[model samples]
Target: MEGQLDHHPTPLGNWLEDLFAKLFYQPDDEICKKAMKEEMSPQLKVCINGQHVPREGFDQVITEARRTYNISVQNSRELLASPDATDKGIGSVAHIQTFTLEDKKTGNQRKQTSLTISVIAFSDGGKQLIELVEIVLDH
Candidate 1:
């Protein structure tokens, strides 16, 4: 029971753009996950620092993210506005997201916590899946 990005028959470009803003950049993992499954193609792939991670489905990405940080995902989400233009698909989105990681064992909050601006790429679909995400770290 899926619908096109232009389910209302508006416009792909504008509809897709706004859909991404709510899903990928939202402050809720549940919301993002739901949108990812709907928008992203089965052939989704991701690259980090020029290193490609093969067959990285949406679910795996979230699982790996939690493991890599060494802290439980407390409340981490993004708020994106719009993106520029790109060759592949939609350009990278400009967003501001907040993340708080808590120690897994002791449940202690990390000292280093801040909000940041990030760029996110989206796929062309009704759901608008995030193809790539790059965050500008704050010192």
Candidate 2:
């Protein structure tokens, strides 16, 4: 089941994770936000802990994140195990990542905020972007 992550490496998941890991180590907020913009679907929706955010979108999330912290993502990795079938078609990928975040001003921080993201991909031509859910599974 967990081996499933390797299956989607060609479609962009690995690249995205690597980008996040790099952003986590960098100090530039704008660059991190730019990278996120490249990864997001135009109309993104995220479901975290059962609370649904409709059309909350990637831009909004980035804006909010920037407002809250210096915004760094660390220790990003993917977890894939036993994917189940889904109706929208790109199938489903189960992946988890851990990152440490620090406050912008105080430099206060927390370690090991693990997240499990469920992604669905859609294509126009040969390009793909994640079109579905992302969430936090570890606190």
* Best-performing candidate as measured by TM-score: 2
Q: What stretches of model 2 exceed 4 Å from their correct place?
A: 1-11, 19-26, 29-37, 71-74, 81-91, 120-128, 137-139
Candidate 2 lDDT score relative to the true structure: 0.52
Writing each residue's lDDT as its tens digit, candidate 1 over 1-139 gives: 4652322212334445455444433456676566656665556555544455554543575555454444322333333434243334444333333444454566655533333322334445333444544332322
lDDT tens readout by residue for model 2, 33-95 = 665556556565666566776544445665665666564555555555224222233444455
Clashes of each: 2, 6
| C-alpha lDDT values of all predictions | 0.44, 0.52
- Taking all chains together, each candidate's TM-score versus the true structure is 0.42, 0.60
Clashing pairs in 2: 1-81, 1-82, 2-80, 2-81, 24-73, 79-96
Task: Tally clashes: model 1.
Answer: 2
Error at 38, model 1, angstroms? 0.8
Give the Cα error of residue 130 in candidate 1, in Å: 5.3
